[model samples]
Target: MQALKEAQKTVVSNAPSAIFPANLDVEYVISFRYANGGQPAQTGDSSTPEEQLEKLLHTLDLAGLRTVVRDGGDGTLLIFTRIRSEKKLLGEIYRSRVRDWLHGIRPAAPEKETQQSIEKEPLTDGERLRLVYSLITLPNSEGGAGITPKQGEWNLVQSIFALHDHDFNKKWLKDWSTKWLIGPEDLKVIRDRFGEKIAFYFAFIQWYFIALTVPAAIGLFAYLFLPAYSSFFAICNCLWSVLFVEYWKRQEIDLAVQWGVRHCSTVQRKRAEFQFDAEATDPVTGEKIRYFPAYRRLMRQLIQVPFALVAATCLAAIIAGVFSIEIFLVEVYNGPLKMILKFLPTVLLSVFIPIVSTILTNFATRLTEFENYENQDSYEAALTQKIFILNFITGYFPLFLTAFVYVPFGEILVPYLDVLNVTVQHFGHDEKYTTSDTGFQINPSRLKAQMIYFVVTAQVVGFVLETILPQVKRTVFKKAKEFDSRRKGIDTQTVLDPPEEKKFLERVRHESELEVYDVTVDLREMCMQVSIFKRWEV
Candidate 1:
């Protein structure tokens, strides 16, 4: 909602002593409001917000911020500053610059023409922004100035700058879809606006999408043209999975270097919930650091093995029960309304699996906390691994059972279900349906059917759960709360002490909701594509 101003810089004509590619140019604002307290106030300087803004700018100058200021009205101010190194120029000389030097070793006029040509060509600019937002978020020695906008000097800071431009990001994504490719520059744009964490996810997935296409195309061909349930296809798919996983590890490192986040984990702050046992000085940095027993944490992590087995067993039992009922209804049941009843098990599984998975996911979070990871990265990784495992069992295991177990062995096993015919009778059929009559066979193509539903239908369901359901729940809750308040004769509408705060809040309110829902879409697409390949092989 904030009207975004493009962060721009003028071209530098002069050279500098050192190349600092890591340095970033960032633009941010700081806003503050007067403190309101019930108790008698202590004697202090009663400076106005405008006067505070002037003082802040002076302090920024002292802290080496070459800032440009503008009035933001009320208790807010807009401050723009370029985070540059002490040197005038930033970044290493590209190889192109060296090539230009080689050209200069020849004739002067030719060298000048080569230089002109190089200069004329448009090039990617801006040093990798590093953690520009982070640098501004912390205290100076700790890497940031603690001059963040949402709060700083007073208790009434209204809003931080907008995280993104809605229209621009929409257009950008539209163009990306039309082009079917995301370049490094596109990822850089995301990093500049949102932050590296989200951008890293995008980058990893973009590479994944591109890599997946080769195998996907091959599998589609095999599914259509190769023999059904081909062992060759299975082997190829397995090989592809292994190759893809290994390749992604190298790709992660490449992206880390490209984003200047190779050392990012080292600077990451301690988790807010992290409890410390002791403190010691870092031998190299001489900084005091919190200490926790790694062995104790590892011992706690050992609990996950049994917990995971229990979760997987519960999910597998659910899946197996669904599969047996489905196979029975389809292959053995001669009961009333057979077609309708055949789908009931699937429908039931669809409803219950997500519910069960949610409960297990909540449990996984507590288990992850028990592991007591030192950094956010490790914590999230472990948690994601747990979710992936839970989903693998809950989502894929049922289909696997149907494809590998039920279909292949239904002839040997399903005949026993004929005993139910004594209790339940079919309306249309006169003859008792037996294993011999239908050959006790379930179609291997049922696997393909399941894959189709998983790929197409599962996506719709996930989108609803991830995007629509949350919005609907929030809206309904808000309305119910408002209605309840009205019944109590209490106002629920937000009221700001200062009028200026209203505009800032309005701008930021929309900005705060600009999360990339496409992330879910992308992840689900990749997952289903992987599932399709694996299922097709079976």
Candidate 2:
């Protein structure tokens, strides 16, 4: 028995261990691609892709980060980053905690005895990633590698992102999908796994979802019991809106505190893209901070006023013109191919709104960049506000025109829509196709039908477009790429992955290909939904 046990132990020790590939040690990934789509020049300044990559590696080394470069396929190089010293990370964590405490963002001071005491608490994935990101992106003067991807000397750098924890993501998705409701603990898990920005978005969504139940119930009751445009229901909805806004403000603060990110805005790092005109010493901290002239930023901001007006004018004109044409086709005109012509307005809206919105969004982005806010938070906030304005016009204006203008004063507006009467007649339509028909009666159900379409049908369609369509497109594209590679007789597997670390490398490569997830997009969707719900309910 003793001899058998010894042999078993020896066999167990000799056997290859299973590869878990947790990937917890990897802090960040830097993706580099050749600008000219070929091998880098042998001799050049950091202007060359190869030279820039070398400089980046040197900077990372100086900042005490471990880096391993690998072929990312498609003439790209992936730099996997890890911390060389836990002590360095611990020190950064300690300093951050201390700053938070000083700024009243954190409730308690960090351990005074030693940095190891701070390490005892252990950094969450979010914290670790954030620190590493800052370490890589902050200015060289601020003790970072100062390698901002696609910026200045690092233009060859395609993207810098942290790898997703596939295990945690799978578990999280399964847990959430299984559960009926997400509790505070679930939110905390999200905060720990992701970061405050993403966590706050989810928290807000959860809060919004719960709060909506009241309005939804009330709206159902009102729909069933009350007359159209009931004053009582309107008042109730208005009250609910006020209460929701006030409570969310309080809840937002509470969540910020709970997540230990309250007053985090105070410690926002200077944006790498921020262009500064001068430097000044902070009165309180006595630190030298880069300064951009307020007057110049103010001048740039003033441009938004005109931009908003132009955007509103353009979008409203398109919507109003489309609405008029649709009314003429459906209500007034008895033209040839009338059913097919009725869908013209829908086609025009589908084609025009997106093109116009894209242009406006791009312009808004440029305007925001020109404003040159000191930090990313402010820049994003400004851009969001601008985009929200554009969205508000495009989203709500049509509904507003239908409900307020068409429904209320359709008899008057119907005559004005006769501007298309000549055009309809010229298209070989009969005289009855014109608005001169006496039989035409304004459809009161039109507004109700439109509301239903927006509230139910539009929501479903938006979900399909936002979630399902993107996923389907990604899968199709991936399969197409694989097929193309196989047809070309290229060994995609061997080219991208080595046998020893194939699983881990494959995971990294997959994550590298994913677009950086923006919490703002989700938040914007939520905000738009709220607007739709508010209008629909009232």
Candidate 3:
């Protein structure tokens, strides 16, 4: 106990504040046995688990550091000590350590040295951040504990999430309106506070917005000044849209590398709901995990291609019927209740689109299940890809029909709708309602108008649907429940006569209010955002 305590003192005392940022302190895995011996019999260490835990608490208390302890369930303890310094001070400390390391002088005690002495000094703030981040990511052999959930000797590390910096997010939103620039430091702050997955999304969004500015400016200029050359702008817009999607794919790869999650998917554990035919041991780690054959999964995935084709055919047929009805009513027909009849297709679409989408989504879910992805990330990614395809067809195919088929060839196509011209005698009008030689005057300006509506009006509607509608539904449901309870004379409110019971019930209520949405919802939002951007580009 004395030796371990002495070692702990040495480590804490000699630890230079330069090696780790004050606010971003290093977490340690204190695994030694306690002297009182609550641990299972081990030949080497004299201490018990309880004794070790007490010693750890005593040592931390003596050092005047606040420690958070997590029980690892297998006689292991995870500790996070409170020690922080200003960012500027940390930079200076790192620089000093670099100098000492280069000159063959030890900056701190051997036990406190986390990184090897480097001859090269980090020059810029970005480089310094990288150096610090790299140090933090290294393994214990390389001077960093690299302590994370499912990593290192303390592999079952509990997740320790810091409180979100809502202030920073608010400031970022305010700044984004005027600044139009999101720096790496801002992304780093997010990555440090949140996980890398979320940070990657923010980075990608920022990158996408910056990339979009050039095309948007050019497209707007062409649209205003070169009205006669509309096709030129349309072609350029399509090309730019394609380029953005392709660029984002590569950008994802780059960000994955920067975030050190390039092959992180490979290390991810299988989802708890996943089923397997057999179990196998990992060759390197000797851990038992459920196993499924890759070939069989691939064969299962081939089923999605046929499903996608079927969905696309159904969607295309619906879009075509809706577009044809719209054209016939708007241009060819001159009859009573014209405006009301024109909305028939739209009303039908509004009613049926959701039904079709839900059916297709359920089918996609089944396909994904059959594919049997090992991890949640992989499962979500595959499912999101399938959903994006469906959303793309339903959301954009109508516009595509208007752009490519209707506008370009409307002169020939609208006349075909007059196949009923021969049967006009049945109406008893005697004067035939045959189509005129001029056919329908298809205005190209309508496409631009539709694009404008989609960009501005549709997005506002979508936002209300995505965010406000759910809350509205929830509020209505809760109110209805309350009304029913009142009618039954059931008191929903807890009586607070007993303080202990009240506190316990209140804790339970608070926990109940914390909701976790299905992963698919988050991925769907991301997919929809991408689709919205693509629509704007088109």
| Count of clashing residue pairs in every prediction | 2, 0, 9
Angstrom error at residue 453, model 2: 3.3
TM-score of 3: 0.58
Tens digit per residue, CA lDDT, model 2, 350-388: 779978998999899889988999887899999999999
lDDT (Cα atoms) of all candidates against the true structure: 0.58, 0.76, 0.57
Best by TM-score: 2
Per-residue C-alpha lDDT of model 1 across residues 44-162, encoded as one tens digit per residue:
34755556556666656544445654334322334545444322222212332333344442121222333343355322222222233334444544434455343335224443342
Ten residues in sequence with the least summed lDDT for candidate 3: 28-37
What is the full ranking by TM-score, best candidate first?
2, 1, 3
* Among all candidates shown, the one with the greatest lDDT: 2
- Better model by lDDT: candidate 1 vs candidate 2: 2
Taking all chains together, the TM-score of candidate 2 against the true structure is 0.86
The alpha-carbon root-mean-square deviation between model 1 and the true structure, to one decimal in Å, is: 10.0
Candidate 1 achieves a global lDDT of 0.58
RMSD of each: 10.0, 6.5, 12.7
Q: Number of clashes in model 1?
A: 2
